[model samples]
Target: MGEHWIDVLPVFSDYWINGEVFTCQVDPTAQAQVSPWWQVPQRLIDQLLKTDPGPVIAQALQQLQETRADLYGRFSPALLEMKIRHLLVQSHGQREGLMARIVTTLESE
Candidate 1:
């Protein structure tokens, strides 16, 4: 059998630059146990990716990149991605998830 990005569904790695968290792109072709693969929790997978949140997330990300490149460039892709994912899960309510956690962590750094 061969491993793919889908096989690693949501694995990631985080780093910091000027206090913002950034997710490093993990090589999905590599073994799961290799570096840069942070096994995301089932809970987050449910909140962010389950039930095909693709359309909503894709729209949000695209719009942001197009309309707000300056601000977008200020933040890390991982942080921006997390913020959009959080919006999808929370949906006009109190948002809580990796984005919140990372934001809190970043503020402290």
Candidate 2:
């Protein structure tokens, strides 16, 4: 299947099964780009220093890109893609499941 981005989901992946194609579901929290994707720098510190957090966010993103590039250099595209897919799935699962676990524990207690 060719690569394509789903407008509703904001996910860029294609899935093929038994000659049918479908878009994968994305996490609801990640439905918006500004949610977990970007973090506000230390609020009190930034406010006290009167520094913008935008540059800090940009630097963090740059560092992540560099790390990803290094990893890609050391691995095949297929392997890297698989690793990224696995990580994304696990991250989303953890984010959703953690809340459920907390709620269940509180109810039990």
Candidate 3:
């Protein structure tokens, strides 16, 4: 299956699936669709948040650099990169909002 971005946090009442794109408590089956990223195994998300994301990004960049030889002629590199970066920015904002809700929930707990 492919991935799509979801902008909302799925508490007991709301959530996301890997393929579908909506947030509602209306479906009893909604819980099944929650993404693995959001479910976050054994609640490691709390521990992960304590660390900076900088090193993660750096490692990703390094990996991409190392794989550059294998990535030649994949697409219109310039246009694809621009579009992907723009989309990533938009997704990042959406993720930020979702995280805010999650953090609020965690704090209140």
Candidate 4:
């Protein structure tokens, strides 16, 4: 069977201080239609974050590297490298936010 493909639609949502929310229009130049395999690194990183203490950057980077190696043929090398770096940075930001919340909760107790 041929590879399964999915369209990547970027959605931008905005929430105002008054509780109003709206979805922004999609940018035509940023649209991409790719296979689900391209999302493996993101999915893996998300799963790792579900653990009790969360995952280390190395673990997420390793997972991304492995996924890129396995699916090298599906995407450009440069694109895959860029995706890996992007995911690592994104994961770091998420971990920092979680840690801040935990610290705040603990301090209040």
TM-score of 3: 0.24
TM-score of each: 0.36, 0.24, 0.24, 0.24
Error of 1 at 73 (Å): 0.8
Scored by CA lDDT, what does every candidate get? Answer: 0.57, 0.44, 0.41, 0.45
Over 4 Å off, model 2: 1-68, 93-109
The global Cα lDDT (0 to 1) of model 2 is: 0.44
Residue-level lDDT of model 3, residues 36-108, one tens digit each, is 4454454464345334344333433344445543332343445434433443345552333433343333334
Best by lDDT: 1
Candidate 4 clashes between residue pairs 3 or more apart in a chain or in different chains:
none
Ranking by lDDT: 1, 4, 2, 3
Local lDDT at 78 for model 1: 73
Instruction: Give the winner by TM-score: 1 or 2.
Output: 1
Model 3: pairs clashing at backbone N, Cα or C within 3 Å: 10-14
Worst 10 residues of 2 by lDDT: 93-102
Query: Residue by residue across 1-103, what tens digits does model 1's lDDT show?
Result: 2434434444567655469775667777965565545567768666665667765556555666686565557678777677666655555332345344434
